[model samples]
Target chain A: MILQLIDIGYLVAVVLFILGIKLMSHPESARKGNSIALAGMILAIVVSFFTPGLNNIALILTAIALGTVGGLYSAKTVQMTAMPQLVSFFNGMGGAAAALIGLVEYGDLPVDDIGKGSVLMASLVIGSVSFSGSLVAMGKLQGVIKDIRVNKILAFLVLGLAIALAVYVLLSGQPKPLLVYGLVALALIYGLLFVYPIGGADMPVVISLLNSLTGVTAATTGLLYDNKVMLMGGILVGSAGLLLTLLMAKAMNRSVSNILFTSFGTAAGPAGSGQDGD
Target chain B: MDAIINYISVNQQEFYIFILAVFVGIEVISKVPTVLHTPLMSGSNALSGVVIVGSIIVLGKTDPANYLALTLGFLAVLLATLNVVGGFAVTNRMLEMFKKKPGKK
Candidate 1:
């Protein structure tokens, strides 16, 4: 009975999320939409604690309290122009949380099923990448990491290695502790390098792409545990972030490939410029 | 063929829900101009904090004695909570300026 009620609560939360996103598209209703989404988050957070067998109550609350203080301090202190950096910083934290969840879940899960293994690995890889990539983006925005352009070849090599590690880990019947953690490390490195070379003008697109990656990671965790609310929330945010990325790219007269492959921003054309060769 | 059909039958509800939500996401995000991009991004950043549910579940269901899972879970909660709080707060700050603009003008 309690389980059913919790599911119903999740359903309500999902509805609020959808409605919130819908209203947010318009200028007139954006604030109301934000408030509704905030309410939905609160409802979901409150409902999770009500699960019957949930342990470590004190620990969870302690972490939440500490996090709240940290969040509010940063949010209050951030300058208006630094909004992009602040968003990237917070998004990175979410990606980290998702990656960490994937790590824990990967350990605790029974590994015979191929589907579960795939989801777990994908979650771990994507979460780590998003976390590190977003951090790089934040650093760039803050002018901390300046004028460092990584060789494109090196980034791709690292990405390839990360994929290789993931495939090997998945194919191995039992999960080896070393390989699993190593997979995460490689992914983190790739993520760091992935966003390192992109110029400031293009940071918006990178941030948007990373946001979607984090959203997808969250969804994978949701699927692994069969939580409808997490799945829906993750997918919704993922798609929204993606759309924003595409639209921004269009506004800048660049394709997604153009942004990723070439240093498009250094040669950023003036407004109403035609598409350059890919 | 039978296996494919069986799989779809089992996951039919999930698949339909997924597809429908994707459409809703596309529709809702269709017309956003660059002006609203910052608030919308910040707001969706808060939405990504939905992983907090997963973190809570992991921490809640874990054996308290397992140091590794406990530590990771604790950190996950800390980070996700921060994400949610920071994302929403930033979005609120961004949106508040819109209201102030008319009055100041």
Candidate 2:
């Protein structure tokens, strides 16, 4: 009976999420949509209490309280111009949460469950990459960090190394937790190098993509635990958000060179044209 | 190749869910006007905070004695919470600004 209720509750939350995204497409009903989605988030939290084996209740509740206070305060106080940075910073937190989930769960996985291992490896790498990458993107947006030249060749090599490490861990028939460690670290470095050189004007594009990546990372967790709310929410953000953004960019004929160069700023849209104060 | 197929065959429901989800995502978001992209992006960020559910699971299941896992899981809960709260709050703020003005069209 309890399981059935949990399932029903999650399905309701999924419907709310879809409604929320659909409503957000237009300016008129967007706020209502956001509220609906917020309700879904709250409902999901409430039902999570029904999940078995929940421990350290005090710690979990305290963390949620502290985080809520901090989030509310910052959201209320931040200026509009820095909205991108705030979004980037908050997105990084999401990534960190996903990566930390993989970290905490990694030790408990059976030594050779290849399927679970594959999912965990994915969440770990993408989450770590998005975590560090968002930080760099935020820093670049705030002009706290200078744009250093990046070599595409080197970036590709690091990505290759990270992928290779992940494959070895998942397929070696022997769990190498140490290599898993290397995989996370390498992905972080790759994220740094990958986003470090993109001009500030191009950040919205990159941020949207990273946001999509974070969503996919989140979905992998849902896949890991077979949770409908998590899986639906994550996949919705991952696929819908990304496809829409890419189609728009394509609509405007945004190209690879545009992503790597600042010239897209003058022509792309408000995000690029107005953002870079440089 | 067989191993890949074996994994998919065993987890066929998940694959179906994933594919159906991609289609749903694509369909729901296909028509957002460019003016609303920022709100949509930020609002979607809030949606991504649904990962909070995942963090809750990890924290709840983690043993209290394992300081490493417990601490990480605690941080995950905290971070995901902030993402949910802050993402929605900020999106609301932006949408308000974009809301129709009294005198303007």
Q: On a 0 to 100 scale, what is the lDDT of residue A204 in model 2?
A: 79
lDDT of 1 by residue, A33-122 (tens): 998998999999999998889999999999999999999999999999998998998999999999899889887777655566677888
Off by over 4 Å in 1: A264-278, B1-10, B103-105
Docking class of 2: medium
What is the alpha-carbon lDDT for the whole of candidate 2?
A: 0.85
- Listed in order, each prediction's TM-score against the native is 0.93, 0.92
lDDT of candidate 2 over B61-88, digit per residue (tens): 9887999888989999999999999999
How many angstroms is residue B86 displaced in model 1 relative to the true structure, after the best TM-score fit?
0.6
Best-fitting candidate, scored by DockQ: 2
Cα deviation at B88, candidate 1, in Å, is 0.5
The lDDT for every candidate, in the order shown, is 0.85, 0.85
Interface RMSD for candidate number 1?
A: 2.0
